[model samples]
Target: MSPLNSALFKNTTNDNIVHPDYFVISGFAGIPQTKYYYVFLCFVYALTIIGNTFVMFMIYIDHCLHSPKYIVVFNLALSDLCGSTALVPLVIDTFLFKSHLMSFHACLTSMFFVLGFITVQSFSLAALSYDRCVAICFPLRFNDIVTNKSMSFIIAILWIIAALAFLVAVIYINKLSFCRSNVINSYFCDHGPLHLLACNDNTPSTVMNWACQVVIFWLPVIFIVSSYICITRALLKIAAASERLKAMKTCTSHLILVAVFYLPLCVSFALGGALHMNARIINMSLASVMPQMLNPFIYSLKTDEFRESIKKLYRRKKMHITGRNT
Candidate 1:
């Protein structure tokens, strides 16, 4: 059976020929058992949504987390929630329900937002690195430097940059004639998959994608790496053993999370423009889902307050149900 003849190709209304061998490399492909695969995917989706939602609620409802320490975490949660929602559900629908009815317009919308939110999440990490730097490096000025107003302004700026990146890609594609096969290799429409279908010269699209990738991924990563090094060095400079230990504890966990989240992205980026179609699809799936899966566990679990909040939230819900039953 030709990959193109699969359900996704049947919906292709254009003259472009869908590649017969082009299978979407997604989470579904990673797991062999379709039943267990979807069950696990659903589990990840539920955990991501619930965990991030809890983080958001803790930041918003709990006054203790109103400080700048958790403000970046809250914003990071917001980005992860939106990013995962944009990518995960569509993949589930395509693989689990066998609904590959994403039209060109719908594909474009989904791709735009997924890229936007993921970019926001990346930059939010950069912002978070800066936040941690301030908290550790300049304890005296932490409050004054990382005010609610300042954090809000930084978040707004990150969103604006992300919006612009999405707009540019959308506008660029809007001008191109998508006369080739419209069957996107991946479950969702991304610039890369859609651009693969373009009949016209894609030099500009390729260049723009590279440029944006550099700015969005690499630039922030540079800042994150450099700032973290400085932060570690500064922490080491502290004289007191207990305070130094506490600082190392914070920095180590955060650094590990940052490395886990960004390293795959660097690998993907290094693969560059000549990557095989299937390889690209696999990388995209991993990059999109892994960070969201790891985030709550990595960032929030060690925090006493977040754990307490989780316990309290579930305990209250259980109590309410028990009371009603009794």
Candidate 2:
């Protein structure tokens, strides 16, 4: 062992706060053919990167997609890209390559980015819901209420709040003294698993766990559901059935995105201990990654604006290529 590792393991201080130099990430241990799972994650990560980048590129090149709703969609795609990058690559490294050892600060860094981007992803969905709600419920005032500037401000606030919240949780994890086993059971440096390894009192970490659940999961879900309720009422108030259908049609992409993101998570949380440990891990991992991979496709295929923007971009590219060849 190196000198730093020696010092860390010795716990020579009078306070008895033992800080280990590294942690062993025992991800999917004892599971059969875990390599196959890692390969699947590699595919998911690749698709997530390409799909989200394409969505963002479409939004950027086409000025018609510069609306408030597209702003929210862009934010969601950005978060999906980031969240998948934070998680999938590291997971592949740890499990596929058998690089299970993670340094103290590295673990904290991973936890912060993973959780922060995920929280942003959740809030971005809610932001999209709000955009849809405003468009359907207040059609005349949608321009004034949900401008690009206002949408940008909301996204900025969500990113700031998520960063600060996860930063605090990571700071709390840093304060913990890991005197016992440093083996994390999850695929990544998860907050709860890391904090549970601490030898000292973990009340704050425990509290933060529940707080994260409420803030990251429950609150956004409630907001999205409530927004949909408002949207439904607004649609009902429309006199013509065709108008109601048209208004509701605008929400299909966002609703699908919401369902793709939240339903697996809801099932995972609901099943809790009823699931086998490995099964739960698989469910949670899928929940984390599948939405990121699917969000761009859902929006691009379902949203008419995105399809139009894509077609515009394609025609522009074709014209440019023909001009260059001539």
Candidate 3:
């Protein structure tokens, strides 16, 4: 059989009348061997959720963390949680049972959340870069403009934009007929695989998909990087060496987070799709999980105010527990 035919028609019924109720995920690394990696995949998924949740919780419980930067940070954590939740569980099911079968609704649901949160993450990072730019470039005017409430409002606006774009794309995708093959070449229901599965003239969905990808993905990356460039230029004018160092320190964590999030995505896009990821599941998992897992660490390590807040929260909790026992 030809390669395209082989990939498309695998595990499909011979009947022309069959409308698929369940779809299969031929994960990048498929079947038996995939099971061996289940434990590690689960561990990565766990770290993604636990680490992000801990940071989000820390931000929520501590009033000191209620600043503009941390508000954006909280939204980033929320995006990570949504994205990981959508993909990892389905992947675990595919690996553990050697069964890649997913219901039609389940597949679409996964596609929606995974892509939605990706949009969320991209715009959130863009907002973070903008915040950093304002602080460094117009330090005096930053207080008047970008307050905590304003940051939260900006995040809300971005979230609404992402959701609307993703929602329209998902609805467009769902309207496409899928009489061809149910075996998608992915670990879960990703856009490319679904596009391949559609038997109709997919021009509309394809156009919308690419449009959303460019707008929600590449657009935000460009904006963030541009903001940072302007930030660096503004910092160069600072007369005091000590002040320059302090300004650079404020940006370190956000810059690192941006790189971590975008690098893997760039790799996957350059390679065609995540299913075609070079190292298969391992590389793909790392790309998806690492940024979320490492974000809290970057913030804690670089920002002394955030670090102290975490420490103080811990001390307070410890005292509370001690008093309760006594």
Which one is best on lDDT?
Answer: 2
TM-scores of all candidate predictions against the true structure: 0.81, 0.95, 0.87
lDDT of 2 by residue, 175-241 (tens): 6778767789888999977888888888998898889888899999999999999998888789999
Candidate 2 residue spans exceeding 4 A from truth:
1-14, 324-326
241-326 in candidate 1: lDDT tens per residue?
99988876776656766877788777777786778656666676777887887787776777666777767778989999999999
RMSD of each: 5.3, 2.5, 4.4
Model 1 pairs whose backbones collide: 16-180, 16-181
lDDT of 3 by residue, 198-262 (tens): 77678988998788879767899889879989988998999999999999988888889888888
Candidate 1 lDDT (Cα, 0 to 1):
0.75
**Candidate 3 least-lDDT 10 residues:** 9-18
Q: Candidate 1: which stretches are off by over 4 Å?
A: 1-36, 271-280, 308-326
Model 2: number of backbone collisions: 0
Best by TM-score: 2
